[model samples]
Target: MNSNTFSTLNRDLLLNQLEEETFDILVIGGGITGSGIALDAITRGLKVALVERYDFASGTSSRSGKLIHGGLKYLQNFDIPVVKETGRERDIVYKNARHLVYPIKMNFPIIKKESYNLVTLKAGLTLYDRLAGVKKEERHTIYGKKNTLENEPLFNSKLVQGSGVYVEYRTDDSRLTMEVAKTAAEKGATILNYAEMTDFLKDANNQVKGIVVKDHIDNKTITIRAKHIVNAAGPWVDKVREKDRPVTGKYMVLAKGIHIVFDYHSLPVNSSIYFQHKGRMIAVIPVGNRTYVGSTESLYTENMDNIMVNKSEVEYLLGCLHDMFPTLNLNIHDVISSWAGIRPLIGEDGKSPSELSRHDEIFESDTGLITIAGGKLTGYRKMAERILQYIEKKEKKAITPSKTDHIKLSGAQFNSAEDITSLTTLLHGRYIELNLAEEEIYQYVLRYGSNTEKLLQTISEYNAKDLNLEERNILAELAYTIDNEMVASLSDFYDRRTSYLLFDLDKVKRSLEIITSEMSTILRWDNKKREEENRAMQYLIKRTLSFKD
Candidate 1:
């Protein structure tokens, strides 16, 4: 049987799998940390089942500032161990997924008066490099004002004293999280999205023996038996754990982070910039043709699922942009799209949310379930190793040490820096392989990486007319998603597969016709079923995009 067929994540299959056999571990949550846990357990030859309540990465993991760097600012607090451990994991992930992760030269603009002074900043960078191990490629480098201006002509020429050292890697958090889950499935883990862990199953001894899950798509209840249960639910960790335990510990304090997107020309910097805006550090990340500037840290009162950008967050981001790049022409009109997510920061009394620790912790309930919390995206794999080690120790199982340090995620295939292709070339190749036109290749490459080959193969049966959609996505890709990627609904394809609705709602709405048409054929949806799926997707699109409008 095809692996795609076996891994189908529709409601019936998920319920059937839960009922079929017991697993060694059942990982609840589908964010990076949970995905990492599933991958680690599966690679160690454990039978695993990983489930997500919503779409994969519909939480803090996807809404990160998208940096995988060792926290340079944390160095001020003397958090050397976090810096060092994150540095090692950063290098490990960058090497494992070279195609997706990039060695970004972050330009920390040194304003003439305060911020980080020259002498002190240089020492910090030196220490950061040392903690990053003895890697030659990752050594820190400082640039003078003349060199900085020459490299990034967009900066305010008058206020720039110079720039700080460059030592970090950047990534698409959503893509990275999804890739980890896909690789976990490839290594023999059952992974399901749209499956919520509603409760825990305890044996006669009140030890966690399994989980009770509900399929969001079909509204069906199911039970999955596991020897070990892990709650890696990102922001929803506390809520998920509450179902299993009495919610004893203060595990998470939700912090809302909002990011605003602008056209590339709006803030045309040659490199990613790290700057201080009202004492909170923000990143101006240049990705493809767009620049994302953001991230305000504030206590969130809303539930994690209902987190949204408020007027204050918009004003805060705009104010930061004005201060950081005073010369740029920008306003709310220049903002193309924006999003917000709640971070599951470890609850502690601090001066501010930014001051909270990024370290992860493991808690074993009176039931045998182990809940891991309070980690950054940069250290998810290491966090997984820690949790798995604890599980092994408790279970008295001798498992091999973590091999994720050297494992390659699915889709990553770049072997060199100069391997990037032009839009035309990329489209031409993608058209031949996936039955898509040249324009749709960007989505394919960004979402699939080298696993695009499998996507293409799944779509090979379709012709040009069947594959071509509204020039952004191909119908073939939609078919492939249903057939291979366990995409149950149009929302899965939109919110997770391509992230079309988030970045460009107008484009996604325009392409929905063809996408639904093709998906309907593959899913064998009748007129009622087709209308139902369309209604469900439209409801979600409205809910997420209505705020901006």
Candidate 2:
């Protein structure tokens, strides 16, 4: 697991991996499921290559509600098996990525007296706890209205006649996506973020073999050869499948889900809330210092890359939140940050998109390309296992069964929570030693777990001039982005490395100068190019970030 194995996702390496070497498998998307496939294949000693048209997790993966639990709502559909499997998988993910995923208790408030009676809510919670394996310490619990208010008084107390039972886990979806990609790269997988699969290359027999790819940064197209190809393109699965000859299987049933991040207190509740909104379930998940109010389910029609939030989606989500928590004064103007992600659902007749199954479907196109469609972030590892099983049976290779359940992700390798705490302490020491503040160390621990040690070492040699940023984000991180992480653009820093724009959009405009200057030094951007990058990030910030007028 030498760090050198991970390299910048630049044009040279992408072209080299594609044209110079024969690959056993090529995964055509860089999201969670695709990253999982790459990790699974490479761990089995298969030569693997993965390419993304945009940044990794730039689509639905990053835009998820960031939960790592079984779909409780799916229970309403009577899909008990899905809930159980996802519960088991959720435990596996919690164990495998302990640093990122953590347990959170959720409360389902029964607003309508007769709509969902206490008996039914209690039954559902009991089933949820059982599906989660009901560890003695983490079993589901119920509370009377008084006890519920005692636990989470911020909840809309007046409207709450009775609230139901509690259970579930919350997570940072973007960080999880990045960590999976990082783990795959550590395990001998070739991963490229800004590389895209343009079309497939077939032999005389018309068996799909490889791909023609374009490096978006350099605008150079190259051919890559592989024995097997996997299409895990998420929302774009339909578009990517168009390249496969005569299109063997139906690709996607696109359902759009939008979430809005509000200022933490305006809608603060200690426990996450899930209630009926227009006959559908919407969750109000509380993460650190913020509340994730989301997820309006609607049919979406547009290219995913260019999809932006219309006024209606924002209004729909806000209205739902208002209905559940009438006391919490919130409107579209209260939206701090908003995003939309398309769930790649299995297509079904006689049903609206929201009613489409969250279950994943695997199809081998007539030309032998495998397209994995549907499923959600919670069940990614399971999805990977399914994909690997298909490849194992098709190739007839005697490979090790999927071991990711046992394999710890990069950040989860700490021997104990104490080790993580010690690393955090070490980061603080280094920051103080470098005359930096304690609060600044948070970002370092977040981006790189123990890997921050390397960043500190690199920064120790630089002077104050090289170690300052416009927003005062430590220069060490920006240097690490250039040296270690393949941060080729400003969006990488603002959107991914730190959620600066999402959290503090106004400061971003003022912070642009320092970031551009440092990035220009590292990325070799000229004055014009640096300005262009700044302008693009500004446009994205204006589009995505919630602002205080």
Candidate 3:
């Protein structure tokens, strides 16, 4: 399968296709929700097209807590429906994308005189497992404080009573969304990034007929006609809705959540830790060689365009980290990288920022514009299913039922979790003959899954004998991402495509010259354009990590 069929080389062709074909569903927003909706619609025999103003998953999808959680906190709030739907959806997502979403153990430490005593904790977890449809063997476990401390000594053992262990699925949100987009493309969906919808193209009745969109890269405008349009633009849903008509009655509330990254050696922990700070639950998880702690939820109203992590938000997350694991002694300077994402929650005037609901809601305006908002990452597939049901009712068509539950995503070829492990080990051993480092091979196999063979082939075909192993690895990844993932900029490659900027800032700095030179060669950019791209990337990294004065 020539994935170059989905590359930027086909960008103009995709626009032409959009102009020529009338799709059943035209989805605006290339985030996880939009990707899910397109995949579902196309698999159901509907002609689907998706356009994003930025690169895929460059919005809230990329900046999530990176957990396909079952909403254990919702259980605390007695919100059973969301907990159940997202819980059951967790396994579905994991089953479909075994390489992207995998089981992670969460340790919820029981503090002294905390709101959750052992009895309440046990009951809540039992109900959680039941709602999540977890098997009896995979039920939540309660551990004594001694055992919990012995296993993970980083926590404040003095205040610990006991611990509750449950399952949460860890995911690379950007990669998951990318795989979904690729899968949708494979099923014959027209997906384009850097394409912004300027205005709604309406019929004589003032109902939405299609959209007038502009491609930012080529600076060309194209009109895409579709029978139906969906606004799944994550945080930007309200703005899209306002384009058709004014929002009345229920609207959206933006809650900004910020996360901080620290090196694993500085804040080492064996298991993902969930602890309460200021009566709100925050999580600290290990990703590769880095430990990331997050998510302080505060009402965000200042600027949606650029949601940078302020010092207060950083301080709040740091406080949460220290409050739970007092021995870490981390400060602001220890932060390697940080990200802030807005949660487009359904607002209730009475509810606090943290109390806002994450339930998905669909609003159908009189003009027939459908906007889907207020959903979580874990529930994206189920959310898409619900949207399709709405679409079927509205369109009055006999569409097929969703098959995403059984369809594995691109790069995921395993039948079971054991199969994934077996194949990964097999590929690791086989790739050693290609003269790659063991750890490098492991990372490649894990990131690309079964596609590691294709990447290895790319590595072998390149003449890089003079380059070090690390340089060769970066070059291979760069070639593949540019030729396959439609990476348009250096920042896109580092931030979303590779995640090198988040965990290894030093590596980004070191690889800058090589990457820019190679990208110039591949994309055919002149020296001035290459310098501009470099400056743009430097600003992106500096702004996110706040390294500049």
Candidate 4:
């Protein structure tokens, strides 16, 4: 970990820095959008500070389908500019954080005499590859019925004419956000999570100047001064905007997206599937020992913050799965975990939830409140770049161009893709004494990239430590995350940091006691605080067990 790493251990110190310095830019959200903006600002020579009500990516960013593709629906609607930009930007995301964002092949099946026949499917993919400026080697491959069946037997073959295999990037959305936040902090941005911005501080002319925030760690009120402020709060964008003034002209419309996870023994997927069942596009992606499928989109108004998947959503998704893979017959009981998030899409009159566009918008209020809302995971860097560009023009400052396009994130060590495989081989042999399985080591490599070596070296230096492989791995991850990743609580580590609460639940339960003990020691929690942390983890775990329709 870097000596100046942002973590719970330095909450007071970072808050002191925030209170003392009046930054050039103070961002009001710690999700990917705000994090990206902070990174761009700091790297381009602007003093920056970011505040999130909860942990970074604890909101919408953490609950996505976790893909880095411009929506195929966007291409179907002829959004060439957006598709082109995101296709280009995804490469940048991969180059910077290959461990978090990497290539995966997706199966999109064609139907006879339906919405997409073979000819239309092939033509659409051709245009899609062209719009994306895809390399010839990575372009779409049309698969015949026999090849399609051989590739994915889970999909229903009754109406399937053929399939198109195309390249799409998969990502750990929360991890990507955390790495971006860390990179921003590395470049001199004072990033604070679990810090809530309570109110806006306005100057004499009613133009924004600073903000009043409540620090959750210590229960203290702190005033942070800044020249410019941006509201990149995802689901709460409108609420934050209304705090500045009455939200007018271009309000927000939110939709709920729900996903369910199943163990590989119950239902397995060899590769990712982009299946359209009854006009909705659902992605069924397999990650090692488990297969997860989603998402059901429905218009949502209430329950904005604590969004949960409902029983109906679960049934609907299971029905969707049956539509594609009839034999699976997965029920709610088969679902190990479920997550739902509100997509803060830009509203249009009479538009249904699925019909609404996914394009992001910037609304600069009359009092100088800049609100950024409605964007996909893959386009976060560009969104941040645009926000910084807006500030540069408004403030008339000599701003430098963005360097994040090529900048490696906090844990990215390799210069190229092939370097990752070589890294795994070397680290496996080097850290064999740890007694962790080779598969587990590779997972660690994927999770932390070059930082895994640092974690192992730190662990190796400890003498007379009594811990098993699981406990030792948990302790190592907790140490690295706290020292380097700005983790604030047990849920942050369990839920977002490693995604253990959802995919790897048994590991979380197995490590919970050790996790709390270490967290208490690291954060200096008393008996009551320790109990509260445990209770919070329980509440979060319970939240993932149900869906809200």
Candidate 5:
């Protein structure tokens, strides 16, 4: 097996290795943060192991606004430090993972009855560019009402004043997390999904020692000893902390954010927009043939496991859309798919969810377990560095400084954007030769970077004579992910690996049977297990459309 091949076929051997080894760092939670910490530690020459209760990025990490941004909205709150740090970090993230994080132009429309006038908006954007260290060519540009309308004719003309066009990097959040985890595995870090930490192992002095994990796959308990344990669980940080001791100090403030998707023609826009409606900020972004508008933040006190978009949230987002683009008149039925996710923000008194700061805080418990919570997607690498620095201080020893900023994530080895463009052109010619659509070549490159060649090879070498080119292509993607990306279930492939369920539901529906059949053969699922997986995927499809009720 390839060093980077994190397949489920190796699950038993990996679990055995986990039980036998004494690691230097044992990370709980397999989200982006935890994956980053594992990668950082392993690169620094430390023995590391990571375990997740569910699939990797199955929680808040998969459900972000999907932007590697400098937090432009934080400027309104005068969070200059956050803006500066994340701004700098954005450049680093893009440099390291260019394939996953690429630049997108965002239009911030200045409207009547809003906080910023044309002059003030320009000033704010000017300050934003300076703080974020934006490159000269990609900095903000101001546009008057006429230009704004010409840029996005869908805006309501009566309320539009002007706009500021700037740059933000768009990404697939879950795929980013998986790549990080896979890179760590390639670097010799033992990472396992569907493995839950059930208890803590303590020494004679009650200092932290190791952990007791339950392998959900085989119903077996394993004891893994480590010198240190860190809790990087996003929403479940508090729950993991409680397994060791009481969760004191600042706790998590669960905030619910929901986004709705539509066909591109329904809410067409040439550029991504950040517009305000009735004192709330919303993001309208277009990815391929679908346009997704999101993210309403409110205090959440519901069942975390059963989080779904309700009719009221959909209506609220639709109202915002109708106010901004009055001509569209989009309603509930127009929504194609929707997703709801929880933000594990730090609790602050007398502040609304939207008003809360996103700065991450580290808490050291009496048992010596470290818990990290609250931060943005763009700052994950910095968060891991801070945790390592904390460990160095606690142990009073010299360790390696973080070199992750220079590490190109797996599949993102291209030296520059031009390299990716050249690769896309070359691959498109090959795909055309194979009777595949030329437009799809770019999307595959964006998702897999230079690793796309492996997918192309798979498509060419596949031995199915009965399948058409499209089916052969879909099955090749499934085979590649199953072999390299640790795809353990139907949902893992559809939801995280490819994002077909969210952005292209029609493709998902059309490819469901073929994908399920291929996965069943590869994973060797029994008939009962196959039925269970099919029903689970069906339930998810129903959930995305449940808001119509």
Candidate 6:
């Protein structure tokens, strides 16, 4: 078997490996944090295994703002440490996953009644640049009213004073998580999704020695032995910790944030803008043919398994959009798709959801289970390093230092962005006869990086003469993700594997029958299972579009 390829076809073998071998580390949760931990441990010469109840990045990791930003809003609360660390981490993430993590210039518009004046905004950005260790060429720049309006004519010029332009990285958060997990698997870490940890396996001293995992796909229980266990279960960290032992100290505060997507023609903007509205910071980002604006922060106490955007949240975002661009006349009906994510923040007394810190903290239960909770998406690697350091100190075992900062993630073999551009050009030239547009090829390059060549090969080798261009492309992507990315379900392909459900809903709607039929054939789904998968995808699409009353 090819070690680098993570495929659902090898599920039985992977599960058997998990049951038979005693690993040095067992990581719970397949989100970014857990994926990072597994990669870090495996590269350090320790045998590692990871298990996720659902598909990897099925939770917060898939529903983020899709940016590898430095938390610029945190600077308002004087969260200097958070700003500095996550800020500096942006570079490391960009360097490692250059294909997924990209530099985008964000404009912070200055308004007349806003709290930050031109001078103060410039000062804050200057400090932000210094804290982030920003490169000289990408440093912040102050733009006058004329230049600002020229840059983004959609802004409400009546209240605008000026703007501050700075560099922020955008990413496909789910894809990044998958690549990290795949890299871990390549390095000899046994990582499996759809495997739920049911109970802890403890010794006579009540110390966690292993875990009993329920395989959701095959409907079997397997006990995997490990020397160390890490609970990186994002919002479920506390719940997982309770299974090991009772929760004692700091706990997670579930903060729900939602984003609404609009067609580019409906809400056209030249640049990504981060602005303030009624004491809250909102970002309007344009990606591909769609523009997504988000995030209303509020305490969420509902079921963690089903988080949805409510009508009020939708109205709140629409209000912000109206305030920012009065000429656009955007409304709820203009929304094409939406997503909700829960932030597992460390709860603090007298702090609202918006006021909670994004910094991560590690907890060691008396039963010797290590749990990491609360962190920004940009700082996953550092969080992994810190947790590994804590483990080494507590266990008193020497291990190799972290090389992830220099170790490029899977498919990111390019030396620089220019190399990616060159590759895109080369691929488009080679595959021009396939009727794929140059722009489409560039997007494919961005999505799969060097793996685009493999995808192109799959497309070229496909012998479907009856399918249309779009259908062929979708089929090739589905086949590649299934055989290589461990895509076991329809939602896994549409949602996390690619963002067709969120950004390209029209494509999803048009190609649903084809995708479902193809996936059923490859995954060996019987009639009942095929119907279940189809129902799940339809419900997911409806849930994303339906607002809670």
lDDT digits (tens) for residues 229-342 of candidate 6: 999999999889889876765778888999999999999999899998877889999997899998898888999998988999999999999988999999999999999999
> C-alpha displacement of 128 in model 6, angstroms?
1.3
- Taking the tens digit of each residue's C-alpha lDDT, what string does model 4 give over 1-549? 235647677787898999999999999998999999999988888899999999999989999998998446677778888888988888889889988887899999875545777778898889888887787888999998989988988778886778999989999999999889989998899999989999999989999999999999899999999999999998798889888888766778888888899998788877888877767788988888888898888888877766767888889888888878888877888899878887788875566656666789887998898999999899999999889888888878675567789889988977777788788888889878877666776788799988888777766654248876667767878887887787879989998889999898878888899899999998889999999999989888888885555
lDDT at residue 82 of model 6 (Cα atoms): 80
Model 2 agreement with the true structure over 232-307: per-residue lDDT tens digits:
9987887888888555335476788877887787777777887775577788887667777777877777777766
For model 2, the superposed segments whose C-alpha errors exceed 4 Å read 1-3, 9-11, 113-115, 348-355, 397-400, 436-443, 458-463, 466-472, 545-549
Q: Compared to the true structure, candidate 3 yields what TM-score? A: 0.95
Kindly indicate the candidate among 2 and 4 with the higher TM-score. Answer: 4
- TM-score of candidate 6 on Cα atoms, chains taken together: 0.97
**Model 4 regions lying over 4 Å from their true place:** 348-357, 397-401, 461-463
Q: Report lDDT (CA) for all predictions.
A: 0.76, 0.75, 0.85, 0.85, 0.89, 0.90
State the lDDT at 207 in candidate 4: 94
Q: For candidate 5, which ten residues in a row score worst on lDDT? A: 348-357
Candidate 5 per-residue lDDT, tens place, 1-549, comes to: 544448887888899889999999999999999999999999988999999988989998899889998878889989899999899999988988899998999999999999988999998999999999999999999999999999999999999999999999999999999999989998999999989999999999898899899997767999988988999999888888888887666789899999999999999988999998888889999998899999998888888877889899999999989988999989899999989999888875565656655689898888889889998889999899999989998889785579999999999988899988999889878666566665677788899988998888888777445788778888999998888788888889899999988988888899999999998898888898899999999999989989734
Model 6 scores worst on lDDT over the 10 consecutive residues at 348-357
Q: Pick the candidate with the highest lDDT.
A: 6
Candidates, ranked, lDDT = 6, 5, 4, 3, 1, 2
Name the best candidate (by TM-score): 6
Question: Per the 3 Å backbone cut-off, how many clashing residue pairs does candidate 6 have?
Answer: 0
CA shift of 282, model 3, Å: 1.2
TM-score of each: 0.90, 0.92, 0.95, 0.96, 0.96, 0.97
Error of 3 at 125 (Å): 0.8
Candidate 3: misplaced stretches above 4 Å?
A: 1-3, 348-356, 398-400, 547-549
Q: Which candidate model has the greater lDDT, 1 or 2?
A: 1
Give the TM-score (vs. native) of candidate 1.
0.90
Clashing pairs in 1: 208-368, 411-450, 427-438
